[model samples]
Target: MIEAQGLFKRYGDKTAVNGISFTVHPGRVTGFLGPNGAGKSTTMRMIVGLDTPSAGSVSVNGRRYAEHRAPLREVGALLEAKAFHTKRSAYNHLRAMAATHGIPNSRVNEVIEMTGLGPVAKKRVGGFSMGMGQRLGIAVAMLGDPQTVILDEPVNGLDPEGVQWIRHLARGLAAEGRTVFLSSHLMSEMAMTADHLIVIGRGRIIADAPVSEILAGRGQLRTRVRTDRPSDLLAALRGDGTTSTFLEPDLLEITGPDPRRIAEAALRQQVLVYELTPLQASLEEAYMELTASEVEYSSHDLSLGPPAQGVSEGSRS
Candidate 1:
């Protein structure tokens, strides 16, 4: 497990990471999410001792990273995929890394096959494609059979199959009782891969919860109701906290009420309801709503002709 308490980082006058505390438990895939400039990379670097913390502490498996006798065997990290010698063959790169930890050549070959890098194991790192480079990086990270794994944007350049592979690999690691912490911008994939989420914005932690809880609390539940008597249904649903909007001549999108409530309201008004469908809140919607105010840089749509006074550009989206 990984635990951080009041972790902070500062560069002169600017604070990159505030006093944030969170725990990544074993047997789960914890996703770290944030907008650009949200200090995600800085925090990850701090965890592995790449960047020193300004005021707090972080530990992996109950000890600081540097305190581990064989750090690679305790925790594996892929903060940057291109952090290897470009001229060396993939196999040689892993061999060199394993040599530092006294890991055997047999273990090196095992990771190569496990990461699907066996075919190109003899190829130079510089000539590998982006997807291949990512695979090689993962192979290096797993070389020591670490109990904790950290990956940043693991699927950045992967194809569909490669994406699925990483998803299963992350879950598989967690199933084996290892701590798996990853960062990604792909909400759809995160929704499928992550069991929990740690959301940060502007150097501060915004949310840390289970995936289901976050979705339930962030976005409103909406229902789509289709009926020939749209007017009667609308009149029955018009009240405080209950709104109806007409999407088509016979289709109405109702908010602030569930499908059962809308159906009963329509029935009491003598309206004919042909369809009532509930729209569950998606992870994308929940993420956007939670981070709406925390985004540091936001683009404006000139077509909207300047946002209203005191309203943020992100909110307009």
Candidate 2:
């Protein structure tokens, strides 16, 4: 597991990361999410000992990354895929990294096959495509067979197949009881891949919870009720804090009341209820609602033109 307590990082007068604390447990994929300039990379860098923390502590498997005799075997990270020498062949690169801790050459070949880099293992890093480079980077990270893995935007330049491969790889790593912590801007992918979520904004932790709990707690519960008697049901359901909207002649979307209460009201008024389905908020919607105010940058229009008129045919010509 990974533990961070009161972690902070500052550069001169600017604070990149404020006091934040969170734990990433093993046997689960914990997704780190944030908008641009939200200090995600900075925190990841601190975890791997690439950046010095101004205050507080972060440790992997009960020890700071630098304190480990074989740091790579303790924590495998792909902070920057392009940090490798561009002129080196993918095979040689992994060989060099493995040589650091006296890892065997056979282990390097195993990771190459595992990451689907066997075919291009002999190709130079500079000639590899973005997706190939990402694969190579992952291969290097897995070379040490670490217990804790950290990947930043692993699917940034991947195709659909490559993205799916990464999703499976992360879950597989966690299933083996390895701590998997990753950051990505893809909400849909994160929703499908992550078992838990950690959201950060403005140099501070905003939310840290299970994916299901975050979805259930961020927004009000809504229900879709289809009844034959729309008007009568609407009246019977009318009360303080209750709201209803008609999607069609017989379909009603309701908020501020549980499905059981709605059914009770319908039965009390002798209304015919055909269907009642609870509608839970999606992860994307919950994320937006939670981070709406925490966003650091927003667009605003400053133009003072007379509300530009529609273009005419002559203007198009």
Candidate 3:
């Protein structure tokens, strides 16, 4: 497991990470999400000892990452795909890393195959394509077979197949009861892979909960109820904090309660509910709603009308 307590990081007079606290437990993939300049990378860096926290504390398992005798065995991280020496072959790089922690060559070969880097294992790092480089980084991460795995934008340069591989790999590792903390800007993939979520914004943690809870909280209730006794059901549902619209004589569209709660109220009033279907907002929608105020570098539509003052068309380019 990973834990952070009142964590804060500052560079000069600017605070990159505010006092944020969160726990990433084992046996599940916890997604770390945020907009640009939200301190996600900085927080992740502190977790793995890449950068020190200006205040508070963070630990993997029960100790600081640097305190572990075999740090690589405790945590496997893929922070940068192009961090290795460009002249080294993928195979040689893994071998060198394994040597640091007494990991065997067999493990090196195993991770190479696991990451689908076997075909280019002997190729120099500098010559590999982006997708191939990502695979190599993953192989290096898995070399230690650690209990905790942290990946930052693991699918950044991946193709569709490579992206799918990363999703499966993260889920597979979590299934083994390992602590999997992943950071990604891909909400759709994160929604499918992560069981829980932590959202940071403007250097602070704004939301941290199960993925379902986050969606349910941010999304309007989308329960369609068809009933015989509409009046009685509406009266009962009014007390349950629902805004309803009559779609027909017997159809009700509810926007504040789950189907189960609606059912309970219908049952109490002896109303016959013929249809009850639940729908949810997409993860991307939920993320936009949650981080509506947290984005630091938000984008807007480009001005198409005319050039600005003192700026020529060629000068703008």
Better candidate by TM-score, 1 or 2: 1
Off by over 4 Å in 2: 224-233, 244-253, 258-278, 299-317
If candidate 1 were superposed on the true structure by all CA atoms, what would the RMSD be? 3.4
- lDDT by residue (1-317, candidate 2, tens digit) is 99999999999998888999999999999999987667888999999999999999999999999999999899989886777798999999999999999999999999999989888889889988888989988888898999999998899788999999999999999999999998976677789899999998868899999988888797687899999998998788788588888999899999989899899999999998999999988888888877666665533343733224422222212
What lDDT is reached at residue 101 by model 3? 99
In terms of lDDT, the poorest run of 10 residues in model 2 is: 308-317
- List residue ranges in candidate 3 displaced over 4 A: 222-279, 304-317
Q: What is the Å distance of residue 245 in model 2 from its true position? A: 5.6
RMSD of each: 3.4, 6.6, 6.5
Q: Rank the candidates by TM-score, best first.
A: 1, 2, 3
lDDT tens digits by residue: candidate 3, 59-90: 99999999999999999988867878999999
Candidate 2 total steric clashes: 0
Alpha carbon deviation, residue 219, candidate 2 (Å) = 1.9
Clashing residue pairs, backbone N/CA/C < 3 A, model 1: none
Compared with the true structure, all predictions reach lDDT values of 0.89, 0.88, 0.88
Candidate number with greatest lDDT: 1
lDDT of 3 at 99: 98
